[model samples]
Target: MARASRVAALAIAVLFLCGCGTVANLETGYRQGWKNAVIYGGVRRDVQSAGQWIDHSWTWGKDLDIIQDIGTVVGVGLVGIDIPLSAVGDTLTLPVTVPIAIYNNSTNRASVSRKTDAAPPAAAVPVNEK
Candidate 1:
């Protein structure tokens, strides 16, 4: 009975080690999300600044980003892919995300420019005014 208990304990230990390794991938996904927040923020600004004449091209890029994020989360957190696969996925998806990030950034920049252009100039104060 003692031997059986020892064997069972060993089996449990081995299984725990194997299974828990994948759980770390959840952290990997979260870290990626935090790292990409700037890109997401630009996308948000694009959404907020969209003009009636603008066709909202950022929507497509935003959808792509969301799809990629969901895929990464599911792949790493739910499917329990290896930790290294997280890096592999990031590498593979860079090409996909980079353009979207750039597009979003440019959109935000243009929006800022338009706001600046539309702003009323400051009133000039008379030098002799008290």
Candidate 2:
């Protein structure tokens, strides 16, 4: 009976240790995944904003206007811009600083710009070669 009890105790201890390790691993993976989602989502939003700015600038000209919307996601903050006016030559310029939470895996913050002169100089050149 004593031998059987000892074996049972050892088995219980081993099971407890294995369960603890599994929990730790699961927690670590969850944290990493959450961090990645925040960083990637921020980057994706920035890219979309840049594309929209380009298309709007092209269609609207210089009369572009943008309204910023700020919110948080899973403790990470995000900023969104809504451009209502898209008319070139209107001379609309605004400077905005947006707060974003970058994941621990990332070494730098995301930067987004909405401006009139983002196009390359080569693209602005006339079709007729000088």
Which candidate has the highest lDDT of all? 1
lDDT of 1 at 125: 81
Best by TM-score: 1
Q: Candidate 2's residue-wise lDDT over 1-130, tens digit each?
A: 9999999998666444332223233344357753333322323444455565454444433433432211122112212221111111011110111111333423343233333457745656568868
State TM-scores per candidate. Answer: 0.29, 0.19
Please, what are the lDDT tens digits per residue for candidate 1 over residues 34-123?
234332232232233333113232245534765555544544442343333333433444555567567667877988888775667888
lDDT of each: 0.46, 0.34
Prediction RMSDs, each to the true structure: 17.2, 23.1
